[model samples]
Target chain A: MDAMVEQGPEGSFVLGKVDDLLNLARKNSLWYMLFGTACCAIELMQTGGPRSDADRFGMVFRATPRQSDTLILAGTITYKMASRIRLLYEQMAEPKYVIAMGSCANTGGLFQESYAVVNGGDLFLPVDVYIPGCPPRSESLIEGLMLIQQKIEKEPWLKKAWTNTKNPKDPQIEGLL
Target chain B: MTSEALIDYVKGLLGDKTKWADPEAGDNFLTVASEDWKNICQTLATDKKCSLTYLRNFTGTDYPEDDEIELTAHTFSYSEKHGLIIKTRISREAAVCDTLSKIWPAAIWYEREIFDLLGVSFNNHPDLRRILMPEDWVGHPLRKDYKQQETYRGIPTTRPA
Candidate 1:
């Protein structure tokens, strides 16, 4: 059984530690939350859908935030839902990385002038990768996911914000409403 | 029913408050006062004959120097219903409008979005929260006068040299 295999020292040990096990968990599975809120959400769906098949890259859509390892803030974020977004970011477990997907999430795209759009997703969470577009083509989202996977492999410490944001000393920022 | 008759019927309810802006790109638009937006939306959505069951989308634009914000609500009517784009302008200073969420549940999210990005307060929206930005995000990102924040989501955004 895979569980029995995982328990074997040779299966998980790397230089006499469980580093290989950690690497295996990080590499084989990365569940993402469906946080699409706008047009970019469409493109994001396309990435995971049949045509793009992001499963090849080890990304699967997650129904709940708790189970997901990554969050894709894929759309224009407005002030009204900004707090809820922050809460969602908090709900995500440790070692989570947020990917700002599309122009709306990255820079508010065309709706940047409208009263309700959040100019950028970064204002709410630390973004590991920013995929730009009015709604970036599906290809762009794929590339962004790959790049994020690369980042996760390189610097796992980037998750510090998810924990640091909870500190009392963290600045409370203002909003439109 | 013809467009003229429908316009006339709406004129009966809104009276002098409705003005038909010239149609462009094959769509007819009507401009109404921000105060009357709720009532007008109800009439359009609930009326059995002129049932506009779908709210296509809405976006707000801020004109700071002029002290006005323009909200454009695009609605699609199922019947005789040629597409109608309703536009209403409100002064930026006291930008307040009744929430249309009561009539169209979908408007709750759209209205919240408008309030979130524009800083306009919807008088009676059931729940108002930021949709796209972080909870601690400062300032409405879309306002023309908005200043670029240096740090967003722990990412440092640099200005052009």
Candidate 2:
């Protein structure tokens, strides 16, 4: 199958492993949910804007969680918002990813000692990539999206579906209703 | 108008109900008894001479050393362009104060926020509930001695050191 691309008539046909083809399609069009709870959300918007041009990497913002492939938690997660965040995560389709896109979302940032703020988004959601900044610059958020793209490229989607497997060390996030 | 004139105007209206007026400090607020708070606020808002019709800011502060919680209301008049600060102290154990929503409708949400953070209970705030914290939150977070609970609905509140 490796020689199929070279042997085929010019621009007529090509062949690749099913996993690679699927991953290729998945990595390019990562639809992130439009959710921002704090200051870092500004950077998230800037990343998607003209200068950072997140759309260039095939990343776009989805308004609802049901259609999103990525959840960028772009600010502080107070205890009150934690359950709502979990609900949003649960609503996202399977094979979804999370990018904790600021110091607050990463480790409660400045509000770490506050009575209301959750320590980090990882406490309630499985975070895929963490972008570190009080409010990370637009460039940093784009970098995080690129990291997610890289991560999607390596996932064996078909194999995992066939085995009915799950990610190892998935935290038990029960009773958050 | 100057703070002294404002204090004198309010004093002339409420008489002994105005417990003490401090015009020389940071806020220039008049401390009124909690029992007379509602009446005094009504007078301030309704009286043409001291028409403090707008509720500028309403907040509560917990003083652990004094064993009291002070509720302050900064009132302003759009037509007059003058403001007055009114304060009332409640025992921390009770933390109950009369609702000013009747005098100025804006006090409703402000009172709810104060209740949410400082544990102050407004006697007749129509819709009294938590405005900032979760409905099931354990304690008022703004209290000086507040201790955050370990977890909220199975989500840990603190990061591992």
Candidate 3:
């Protein structure tokens, strides 16, 4: 349904309605899981700290995956930790989002050649937004959160994300363990 | 005590069992055969003249050209305030050496680390398992000829070629 609007003498302005209201609510209250794997974790903590204050955007961290709507992967993902990441992603509610918060989580960064590191978070769980930098600054993470909010505002509650949210070729990266 | 004096003291106890390492080098480091490792370590730790009571560092290095892995142990005596560098070489085909864990106590974990990285086995080691790598890891990464597996679980161990 089209958003309601009332005609003013000078111009027209849309009225707050059911769909717009849902979008507003969804965009504001994004509870992300409290998770970090490496150096990027320090930046993640700074994002939640007073100066950067992610809480101003209505973003707070949940202790468990089940209660959170977002996952901010804040470091390197080794083959050993990939399965646990998958399990955490699966535990989140259906309308979940993932933020790959640093170069390591995005493309394995310095550890790319390492025999143990996973190339990217998307290899195991679908990543919605990727924040670059070996370890992205706290402000960058806040910007990433804002982008997730923008995405939530445009997306419908029942509709799946437009981007393909599929686990890569293999569910688990096979190794000794 | 100086390194030279320390070398002489060890020689007095073990006689021909120990020898000055690297004849060309002036350092007092001593090298013992793999078969004499356990006995030399015990005598050095217990005997009053040379009590190497503390195990400062115990590690292994791979020598691919020589086809042997060298195990080095650095021990110190709190009473004497002197240290000794003991080394033993084991064949790469069967990189096994006696465990000094019983004498040094602190050597148990170091022995496990050597076993983990360089694939050097310690005879009679209480728990010889991978200490740095995952327990299920295929091969010792520190070995000179180690070949990383193509995939661990289902994830490619390397970046796209």
**Which lDDT value does model 2 have at B65?**
100
Tens digits of per-residue lDDT for model 3, B1-161: 77668777777878888777566765457788888788888989999978889999998888999999988898999989999888889999888888988898899999999988888888889998887776678988788898989776666666664
Tens digit of per-residue lDDT, candidate 3, span A1-177: 356788999999887655567878888899888899999998888888899889999999999998998999999988767877877876787678889999999888888877778888876666889999989999899889889988878776655454325445534433322
Clashing pairs in 2: none
Interface RMSD of each: 7.4, 1.9, 2.8
Q: Model 3, retained fraction of real contacts? A: 0.58
Best by lDDT: 2
Number of backbone collisions per candidate: 22, 0, 10
Better of 1 and 2 by TM-score: 2
Docking class of 1: incorrect
lDDT, candidate 1, A1-177, per-residue tens: 022323454566324324444555686687889878888888888888999998987889988888988888888776656666777877888777888887778777777655556667766567789887777888998888778777655553433353524545432334322
Chain B TM-score list for all models:
0.84, 0.93, 0.92
**Recovered native contacts in candidate 2, as a fraction?**
0.85
Sliding window of 10 residues with minimal summed lDDT for model 1 chain B: B152-161
Score candidate 2 by lDDT: 0.85
Question: What are the fnat scores of the candidates, in the order listed?
Answer: 0.04, 0.85, 0.58
> Over the stretch B1-161, how does candidate 2's per-residue lDDT look in tens digits?
66678778777877777766544756666898888889888988999977888999999888999999998888998888889888899999988888988889999999999999999988878999999987878988899999888877777777877
Residue B155 displacement in candidate 3 (angstroms): 0.7
DockQ of 2: 0.70
- Candidate 2 lands at a TM-score of 0.93
Runs with alpha carbons beyond 4 Å of true place in candidate 3: A1-17, A161-177, B22-28
